[model samples]
Target chain A: MDFFIQQIIQGIAMGSLYGLIAIGYVLIYNAWGVLNFAQGDMVMIGAFAILVTHIFWGLPIIPAFVVAIIICAIVGYFVELTSFRPLINSSNTRRLIATIGVGIFLRNLVRVIFGADPYPFPSIFGNTPVKIGELTIIPQNIWNTVIGFVLVFLLTVFLNNTRLGKSMRATAQDREAARLMGINVKQSMSLTFIIASVLGGFAGMLISPVYFVIPTLGTSLGNKGFSSALLGGITSNPGSMIGGITLGILEATSTNFSTSIQASVAYIVLFIVLIFLPNGLLGKKESRKV
Target chain B: MTLFNKVYKATRIWILLAVALTLPYWVPNNYYLQIFCLGMIFAILTLSLNILSGMTGLFSVGFIAFFGIGAYTSAILTTKLGFPVPLAMFLAGVLSSILSLTLSLPTMRLKGMYFAVATLAFGEIMYQLFLNWTAVTEGTKGIKGIPALELFGTSFRSYSKFYYVILVILILIIMLARNLISSRTGRAMLSIRENDIAAEAVGVNVPQYKMISFLISTFFAGIAGALYAHMVRYVSPESFVNAESAAVLAMMVVGGIGSIPGAIVGGIGLTVLPEFMRFLGNIRMVLYGASIVLIVIFAPRGLGGLIERIDNILSGKQSLGVQKKQQHIEGEE
Candidate 1:
């Protein structure tokens, strides 16, 4: 029972990270229907950014965080401007292939820059086990879980109350309709990528404190992002948040309790979700009249 | 391009097959001979994937799973059960094809990127099972000493002999692919790929044709996997990693997705590029990956497609349908 509870709390903490990453996927997916295979690589870039700013340059933690987020957003915006925007006006197939190209290019490019070493980031939370109710988890894990929920809460308010957020949502619903409504479709798309990339970068930075920072750092969370996106049902913000935590915790529990070969768990979870809930947990159900 | 069209059109295929079938005996060095032979098998694997990713419009991330299936099946049947290599290879192909059908039934219902993800999961499951089922698959240690495809009662223990056996298989596969892709079935698959809803509206059996293409492609993968096992004389979990799948997909993309020539040329080009890069020391990998970027961005149609365009210009023939479609595909964006 003690082990199970510990596993559950840790799982929630990890799942919350997945939820954060999944938001990046959901945001771009909503604005533009491409899966942005580079989403993972973007997270990788984020980790690298944090690595360069703090680990390499010996910058303070808070400034490094800001720099990482800004750099990540800028890279995301550049990727959209260079690769995605041109392909957007083309076929979805072309867009997909192009994005995959970006993914391959970015991963390999990072490989060149970072030299494939998994480095340790300085933890903002001191190295200690945080305990609550007979459940002891990594202090960083607890921090991640708490901060993830708080971010989501703020994000929801931003989406509902902010003019830019509503414009982004409007663009997501229908590009043509949004254009008719005087929303700049191109700017909205760019904003979506920027916002998503920044969020993904933030997740990477947060994860780096407790995680292995490497070129393939994002590779581990790649499919989980997709899984959470599916979990969120792709149409709702709350759906994405709930889905991310759910997937992360489920995977953590499975890893802690089930077979130790947990490498298979994420793919397994994805396969099961794809099979059972094709539209995802919070996905809006659709009916056909044809 | 008239050159490609004339070449792809019976006359060219016959000459190509004749040369490929006869080249193994002509090569003097055993290692170089073996490399060409291995290339033949890899070509078949690429061609098999091409049938689906290239012709049918379905991108299979787990394309190599069927190949792994074939390898394991053949390895087990020949080594453990003491069956003949020929029978093992045949049955391996059959089993892999059947497995493809099974996977397709449940997963093919998913569309676009969903299909890609589902196939990836399928590949992972297959890998895990292959690793864990120690009773059958021998765990991570893997089954070794898989017998070679011997013919005329002669075991192909030597590179020279194995060369001929693989050469023959590659030729046979290429011919079969050419004939199959030119048929009505191929047309239906391409139609489905361009737009499934439109194809379905026109009475194309979207699911059935896709399943068939996927199955047939896996059949080829299985055959190649069995050959690869025997060619290396070993079967291990490491041989069938997601990296191998990515390499195969990379070949298909670089060679030109959906084009037969693209698949073949891409296979050979990529297979040879790394070998040539090996001389560049460790920096070879960085340069090699850079080459992939250069090709996709500049000549997205791959080497085969590029060669076809040049051939068109030099010979005064219209671009082949494949080239036009690839151009159309890129142009649509």
Candidate 2:
């Protein structure tokens, strides 16, 4: 029973990380209808930024985290300007491919700069286990979950209450309509990318201590994040959060039974969900007007 | 329409074929020959992918999964089961086609991005299976020392000999693809690409045609993989990573999404481009990513389309129908 509780707690922590990453995916996807395949790479870049500032340059943890988020946000802006903006009128496949190209570029660039070695990340939260009855939870895990939920709450409030967020939503709903309504559609798109990148960077910084910082870290995690987003509802923030948590719990439970299939669990779940429910768990059924 | 034009068109194919047939002789250096051989192998894979993605308009990013399956099947068959090379290669294609059928049947209902994601998941799943099923795949250690391809008691132990074998196979595959593209089934595929609803309205069995296109494409990919396995005499999970699939997709995009000649040119150009970029070392991948982004943004029509346009302009034969066809292709995207 203790082991089960521990696994669930671990799952929630990991799922929160996934949720944070998935929110990034949701933001970009909701705005531009382009799945940013580089979302995971953004996370990797964030972790590396923290590594440079805190570990290498000897900055404090909080300052390093803020710098990392800013760095990633800048990268997100550039990604939109260079890759997304130019191909605005292009096909979805082309846009997706461009993002993929950016991912490859970012990953290779990191490898060239940092070399191909994994680095141990300095944990922001000290390595202490908090015990509740027979259950033991790592401080990092608690921090991860708390931060994840808080961000989700803040984002939800922003989207529902803020003018910029409403404008972004308007653009997502209908670009032409939003443009006619005097909304800066392009600016909204850029803002969405920036926001997504910051979230991705935050998720990276939060999880780095557990997964370590590696060049190719984002490839699989990004895919899983993508899966989580798709599973919840690509366009729904709450859906993605729920989806990530569900997947994390399932993954944890599955790991208990067999370790060999751990690598493929997310993909397998994605395949099953896509086959059975193409719109995802929380996605609305879209009607096509021929 | 003119006699001179007719004669020029008729002779052009022969001229191209002669040059291709005698390429190995002209480039007798084993190192360059090896590069050309690798290019031809990729050409087969790209061409096959073009059948589904370019011609049929099913953009699958997981074709590498089929390639990997084919390579592994042939390797396991020949090395473990002691089967003949030819038999193993043939069975490899068959098995890959079967796998493609199973995967596509369930997921073909998905449109566009959903379909791509499903296929990507399938590819990742297959890769995991390859990595984790250590008892069969030997885990990360990879399977090595597979025997070379043998035909008529003549082993293609040398790169030059292997070059001819791959060349012959490529030629046959090209001919098959060309024939199919010009056939009624090809028209059906084009219609599906343009609009599957319209195709269905016209009594085309959309799902069935998609299945057939997918099957044919995977069959060719499997053959390319088998050839690759025998040519390299090794099999490993590393060679079939998702990045490989992306690379192949990059080839198709740069070549010209819907153009056959484009696929050939793109595959060969990309295959050889990396070798030339060796001086750049790790920067090559960065450049590769930049090139893909730049190409997609600037020349969405691709290198092949650009060449075709230039040719039409230079020959003073820019026809309205050709322009209309190009527009239609772009519109389908």
Candidate closest to the true structure, highest TM-score: 2
In model 2, the runs with Cα more than 4 Å from the true position are: B1-10, B313-328, B331-333
C-alpha positional error of residue A245 in candidate 2 after TM-score superposition, expressed in Å? 1.1
lDDT of 1 by residue, B1-333 (tens): 455455555465477668766776787677666666666677889999988877787777777788899999999999999999998998999999998876788776677666777787788778887888889999899998787777777888887777777767776777888888789998898787777777899999998999889888898899999988888888898888665776787777777776677777777777777675676655565565545645666665667677677656444465345444433453121
Model 1 chain B scores worst on lDDT over the 10 consecutive residues at B324-333
lDDT of 2 by residue, B50-138 (tens): 99988788888888999999999999999999999999999999999999987899997887778888888989988988888888888
Error of 2 at B244 (Å): 1.1
For model 1, the DockQ equals 0.35
TM-score of 1: 0.89
TM-score of chain A of each: 0.94, 0.98
| Candidate 2 chain B minimal-lDDT segment of 10 residues | B324-333
* Candidate 2 per-residue C-alpha lDDT over A159-179 given as tens digits, one digit per residue, 9 for 90 to 100: 889999999899989999999
